[model samples]
Target: MRGGFCSGGLLLLLLIAPAGAAGTERADRLAFEVPPGMAPAAVAGDETFQGGFTCRSDAGENSAGTTACRSWISPVLPLFVFRLAWHVDSVTAERVVTGIWIGRDGASEPLQEMSGLELRMAVPIENAGFELIDMDFDGHLDMRIVAGGTAGPNVLYRNWLWSVDEERFVDSAALDEIVSPEFDPETREIVSRWRSSAAEGGVDVYAWNDGVPVIVHREVDRFDGPARCIRTFYDRIDEELRETGTGSCG
Candidate 1:
């Protein structure tokens, strides 16, 4: 999901902007550790870390995005924490969270860190955050790193699926856009809801097909003139879909 949808798609901003401002909040910036033992290995390929840690995304990315309030503990990797910064420049040099770090544990030394990073967006400073969850249901943990804003052509997406066999984090190509993606175990599917346009957008449910996420169902809503409409689509599934919606903006 990280590479497909989150990679600079021309999406429309929703009426209600996502909370957490445009950039990382200075007050909530978490301190990183490079203890006596755990030294950060410079990630290769990831140009964002060329000069240590950079917020620069792809070349043509929008530089006016914000990184707001998103730092938190990994849902599965309780030992680590992460946060987003719209612009890496929005914070002081010490507080800028350029990459994942060994968090608040009192471990006298560093635990582990990625050896290299390969950012795809214009700059990590645009708008981005991280979500740690088990996208592969391996009981370990998976990570989705998003750069750029929530929408438009400046968003960035990256996923690291835990490989139990190799005991390492590897790039995931079977995702949509990890912009806070939702998963359902019962159906074994991943779902996403986003603003596609000023008056249109929809919900998508994807299932793993040949290791990649395939859209299995979709429910789209559109507002034109003085009217509002909705449409639904089902993919290669054999189940009755019952949808129920509530409320409306005044």
Candidate 2:
């Protein structure tokens, strides 16, 4: 059988955004040892680092986006923490975030100084954070950050897949474009749902090919009339999404 719809694609964003922001706030206040032996110290040059820390760009000042926030990623091997630094664009005045440092416990310096960062603007800044998940189901955690403003229900993410052999994170533009993405380990597929309007939306199923996501199937639903809705199905053939059939809206 093919993959089915997630309970609610957009719901995940609404639930996760606030939780992550709150968790960061709590971690910033509390002083606790993470990964057991790591001595508490200031991270990213913030002086008050007790355990977990959050650094913010001064709201009153017009300096570049120089705020850095630290959060410990859960359930990662060779446990480490990542710091996301925000810089304000001089002309646009938008706050942009990029991965700056990745450090393990007991390390004097960071394990890696992240590079090739795709700058993404986080409007509210508070909702700006990072999540570590295995994007390709390769048993390695990858980084995904809130890429843009969340005024709309459809939230977008900037993705970085972890490369085990290379010992670094590689950015995936294809994965970043998938909205409200969900991974199915059983089928080894990625599912994305999009809403164009209240009456128009669609679902896209993607398969990984050579470390990139390619659309394999698509389902579109839209209202035809006052009370009528139509569902269209498309299959990817020869690298194109071709309409194959139609049916009543499910």
Candidate 3:
């Protein structure tokens, strides 16, 4: 989900408003999923989330090693869907996907396809994969792709919000590595934690305002020694940073 793996699979719905539009149109959708695949039937996982599609796939797995792939489609403005068929090599873990044209009713064509390489998937379909969600309690859904660290500690991801005014997905700034990013529906906050060290870390609570994620609360805990440490609290809502206690055993 982060970038380059299996080459496909994720869903996102967007509602954009064009110039001089009365209010807003219906929400368009882009669905991607790794459908069930078999070993000997085909060269790639050429499956679709939508029923009855004329999609084409030129992806090959004739090279050395095993290959994995997934199917994906994105919604276009007027009346069309963009589909991609991808594959990956088993040994090298190289991945590739081809773009195919799809119609409204799920009919697709392989006209002037496009391809790329760089994918790695050894196990079965991951349950904790990418997803399309309305992070800010908005009606429109946004795209979220998760990328884990192979060796490093930082986790990276690509987030694109639905721009109703622009009629497309607006890419958000890259998010740095954090412990947990949990969103509370009742509080309407995204709870995140950043660890400075083994015993030192901070928690950042943020809220989404008009599609913008902003910090509203922060708590930093550091250990000066074993039983002598301090926990600093920061109320970002009022821009207040205070040390309520000192010389605490935590």
Candidate 4:
């Protein structure tokens, strides 16, 4: 599944716009093809659980010359939450989601659902923040490390932490402290952190202990008039990490 965090403006649109409308109008619709031999009921019903997590079809439509679907699951507290958004071609029936998955516990594996498929990935440490990136250059998908968090006003920092791939979030730190100082993928560290003055945004880092991923979160607030900034962290507990290391030592 190809996906990433929603930008502040987009996030607002998602929250306020009628379900499935923004997705059909703004997102490029894809041809959603069901695997051969799979039952039509597979994508039916309001919700289904794949690999121990729940997947739900939050909304759907066929009125606007497009078909759309959305799904979400709360895998962990303050980190490791999964969300999926798909816009399907009205004629071809192809689908794609702007997927979002976070593991608040380092030990828990990441849960994901995209393109009407689901899978699990090993994540050794609880993430501060993560965003979907086309890392392999396959145009398939990859995850980018943004920051880490365990708890506290997490929604405010979601965009800053999980929205950018390399430097987009880092470049805007002065505008929001919830931004991690830096992201070094080779070193697996998100360093040099500041805090938010607004009540809604912050950052946090988490790691595993005794095979359990621990969570830490930081928050910030930027009162840009009526426009408020918020960040959040979520962790997954079902998946476990296999190695030990520190992310963003600073």
Candidate that would win on lDDT = 2
Candidate 3 per-residue C-alpha lDDT over 3-122 given as tens digits, one digit per residue, 9 for 90 to 100: 111100111101112434321221122333324441112113321122112222222235322111222222222223434333444564543222222233344332222224222323
Worst 10 contiguous positions by lDDT, candidate 4: 1-10
Worst 10 residues of 3 by lDDT: 5-14
Weakest ten-residue segment in model 2 by summed lDDT: 8-17
Alpha carbon lDDT of residue 219, candidate 1? Answer: 60
- lDDT per residue as tens, model 1, 96-156: 2234432234442333344234333433223344455557543444656653346542233
Better of 2 and 4 by TM-score: 2
lDDT of 4 by residue, 1-250 (tens): 1111222301111212354766555433322333344221222332221111222233445421211222111111122334333333455443323333333323234333223221121222122123432221111122333233324323222222222233121122321333343333333333334433433333343332442223333322334456543333233335532223212111
TM-score of each: 0.48, 0.66, 0.49, 0.21
Name the better of 2 and 3 by lDDT.
2
Error of 1 at 47 (Å): 37
As a TM-score, model 2 comes out at 0.66
Which is superior by lDDT, 3 or 4? 3
- Give the CA lDDT, 0 to 100, for residue 126 in model 3: 36
Instruction: Judge candidate 2 against the unseen true structure and give its global Cα lDDT, from 0 to 1.
Output: 0.59
In candidate 2, list every pair of residues with a backbone clash: 65-86, 65-87, 65-88
lDDT of 2 at 49: 27
Candidate 2 positional error at 111, Å: 2.8
> On a 0 to 1 TM-score scale, where does candidate 1 land against the true structure?
0.48
